[model samples]
Target: MLGDSAYKLALETKRTQAHLPMYNEALVHHLCRETRHIMGELETLLQSLETIRDEPDADTRSVAAQLAVKHATVKRNKRCLLAYQAQRLRFLQNVFWQVGGVPEEIKPQLSPAELDFFSGYALAVNTYKAPFIDLDLTVSDLPPKDLYIEVRVLQDCGEVQLENGSLLLSKNSQHHVKRTDVDHLVSRGLLQHIDG
Candidate 1:
């Protein structure tokens, strides 16, 4: 019962490996409450142990065993909480790298703290990339076979300025552009690459 909430959080984290699940605020609170309760119990046991430290008839071993168990429970709960949060942070970082920013659909599912982290991460990445104006770190790892690729606009993005010239992007319109120019848009789902 003491570690049930933490166990549930661990299971939830494992179940949603492919995508992010909604933040489980209620379960987290419950786990925190459980930890606090255990800590209080632990403190009382400690005081009792201190009082019975020199008493010959007192069963000090039993109190010491209880304290150990409670201490272990507290450590387990802390670990589970940290693991759940760390997993979520890693997932958010991956999503940021994939999309250049958090997608609108995923925004509603993130906690406020996560959203703040995302914003901060985006800023940090941009700062890290500031010097490499010609390179995009968010693009695919595989090297491109061609410099020019045809892309179909998935939505009206208005006019976009490129290295060579400006192009009017309208829904259902196709344009042959440099791969580097549209990689970000493609990742954002505003355009689709056409294979030749």
Candidate 2:
């Protein structure tokens, strides 16, 4: 079953068709088919790795080295396939993507502040393709702590506060953000370093 956020996103996507390439539906269809194939291949590679891991009779050391190399190769290929799919989505939908979802194959540039903001804010976001202008506008103020918790179930923790207000959670906390996500959020002026 879809989560509430996913269900809402599905509805919004149906209403707006922001991610579909209707102009070239045929092309997008083909791309989607190919993307599914690539994903299946990636899954197979992962399963192969698991098989090698479970092969008690096989040379575990050689299998470990092979699995690492296979994993990297799978990652690189999956990235390329994803980029292609994203480009195809852009072409089909003719809708603008968020600054962060511009397909890394296009450019990897993101400012430091945006990095911080995206990093911090990513912890609270659901889908990147949602109508973000409204929600994105609220980054400066941010959702209340409990509300953020409601929206993000799998997101990393961005801001944390201790039970006491003396020391910052960042000081004693191990919570961290990815550099890209940090750039994505901070550039938009969404994250503020606050005293806890």
Runs off by more than 4 Å, candidate 1: none
lDDT of 2 by residue, 66-179 (tens): 556545544544454455444444432221223433334322333343334444554434455265643443232333443122111133344544323321223223323322
Q: Cα RMSDs of all predictions? A: 2.1, 20.5
Regions more than 4 Å wrong, model 2:
1-22, 56-196
lDDT (tens digit, per residue) of candidate 1 on 1-196? 6688989999998888899878998999999999999999999998889899878888788888899999999999999999999999999988887788888888888899999998998999899999998889999888999999999999999999899899999999999999989999998889999999
Q: Output the lDDT of residue 184, model 2.
A: 38
> What is the lDDT, from 0 to 100, of the residue 96 in candidate 2?
22
Clashes of 2: 22
C-alpha positional error of residue 29 in candidate 1 after TM-score superposition, expressed in Å: 1.2
Q: Judged by lDDT, which candidate is best?
A: 1
